[model samples]
Target: MNATCEPRSPRAVRISSSPAELAGLGTLLKCVQAGVGDVPALLALAKDVGDTAPRPGAGRTALLWEILASVTAVDVAAGRILEPHLDAAAILAQAGGAAAADFASDRVSDRVPDSVPFEGAWGVFAAEAPGLTLEAGDAAGRTVLNGSKPWCSIAAQLDHAVLTARLAGGGRAAFAVNLHAAGVSFADPKWTSLGLREVPSGTVHFEAVPAIPLGGAGWYYQRPGFAWGGIGVAACWLGGAVAVARSYQGALQKAADGGREPDQLALAHLGEIDRTLAALIQYFARTAARIDAGELSGPGAWSEALRVRGGAAAAVERIQTLVSQNLGPGPLAFDPRYAKRMADLSLYIRQHHGMRDDAQLGALTFKGGHPW
Candidate 1:
């Protein structure tokens, strides 16, 4: 795999002083030592790290800043696969009340068992199909749900899922369902993509399955934490791109061993990749600092999160094009880890709603009040 190009000038890395930084550095060190090898293996490892609460009861953004630090240090699908449950748990904890107790049970970071996945993609597709629906059960604190939930990752592997369903009375609501419940079943994996085959996503059918509502209707996306989670996704993409840059390093080493000079054009492309990734990382740091300080709130949080996601997606796409060109076939064809990272990232970043998100951000931009 390619390595990140070494800087010509020697510079010492700064030591992290804040709790978020310390957590990130510690996680990053662990990942660097073990590193993220297999995509599925990382998720399994996360599941096995039982009872690990991320700074227990810490604010949503603070927890995300720390966890996501390691995510980028590793790779894409590894982070994306594990993020939802952690994000859900933290968000639930911050929301407090019965919702907190529900997720805080064995389902979340409590014992980590295969962890859990938040399945809400259907909410985005509600206009086109029949999404899952929820009905109040005869028993108090219980409800029955039926219909299909799509874009479910690691469907059979996860023991529980947090899904959004249409309430019988009409508005949308989030429900936490135990996958092993009687009426729940996982369909054959329908994902055929080259990237992220490890975390296959498909339709999950629920038939009168019992569920616990998470917050009230519209409570799911109407919080600052939603945008915080988006920033976490961007962090994953940044990590994947970093892995790709590492592959380029291997290419440089190969050339040196062959007594060949580094190609100017390749170096130029590498320069761009380095600059782009550096800027993204710095941006995350600034935002994370704001998050930790409780400064990232109000109407601006989501828009700011949108900008970070858009910028990271754009950087990753640029890196993909540049890396493929500069290194040619060797890395893509021969380097297994690099190849997997690139492929996984390619699919993982699609989680960012392409032109639609860009358009939304543009509209926000045109309104002209957003800070530069």
Candidate 2:
């Protein structure tokens, strides 16, 4: 209500994704500088007081902020906000245990250490992908890690990170690593121009590095909270999608009211885009509510998480394409918000893993009770 859709997102949610109207916290947008397309301004938003840390059940609102922030900050800021939520979820899953969760629980709660950047490095790029090789051997009573982890975001700037590695015997174990520890070094940044350049993600090399072992081998991925965290990433994607599509909102509205001139050919595309956005927004709202209610569990949870993620990724691709086609070169060339958002969302959703991931959902579906 404060302004018409800003050719960005969040400012005009009332006109798009109803029932999820973005209100207040408009300050999060200033975190980006369109002309520069960098994240220093966005990163500055994290300098809030200790009380600014997210509390329990703040995931949905946090996700909305992630979306809103992406409209301007180009997802670097949103991603910074998102990783901590995931860290909290992981720790919250292992609350009673004193294993690796203890380290995470100690740092992720109400009084989390302020301004410490954390990244989650779980993706592997090697086709052979033996995974981050780790031996169970002891080094003077300290756990020794040797190998590399791909997608370690901003390891240079990050003080700590959560990682998953393959043990000598082949089972996967999770660890909280100190980037400043001895023998920990980062490969030159491999991520170039896929849109999230500000994130600085690449492979991190560890030679006899020290790490704090967290939960058991399977706890990192098997826990219910893992699925919830997956949904949070989808929320970020949807946020970026909304921001990208706002470029065509006026066209969409005029088309809906009978296009007068100039863009009559875009009418059908605009209408379809509107419907597509409505459905995606509804699904996003439902999933976020389920997460907040702790209703996503049982064997069906991962199935449902995949449903949200896959659907959001597809919707984002569709919206980005339609918006670009309908609006032509004006926005993508002159409007930094639209250009950056399109690039960011398009790249970020690549986390979906394509058919390889869909195959996991297929396996779940064949087992029945698939919560679609």
Number of backbone collisions per candidate, in order?
Answer: 9, 1
- Superposition error at 370 for model 2 (Å): 1.9
TM-score quality measure for candidate 1: 0.80
Task: Judge candidate 2 against the unseen true structure and give its global Cα lDDT, from 0 to 1.
Answer: 0.57
**C-alpha displacement of 369 in model 1, angstroms?**
4.4
Residue range 1-372, candidate 2, lDDT tens digits: 011135343352432233443444344444333423344433344333112533323455444434433443334335544444344434533533454344445453332222123433222121114454444335666566787777666566655655677676667766666677677788897677757666767777878876666666776678766676677567667667666666566545544456445355566776777788788777766766665677765566788889888987888888778767667777667766556667766777887998888899999889885754
Clashing pairs for model 1 are 1-247, 2-246, 2-247, 2-248, 2-249, 2-250, 3-246, 3-249, 3-250
lDDT per model vs. reference = 0.63, 0.57
Per-model root-mean-square deviation over C-alphas: 5.9, 6.1
Sequence-dependent TM-score of model 2: 0.76
TM-score of each: 0.80, 0.76
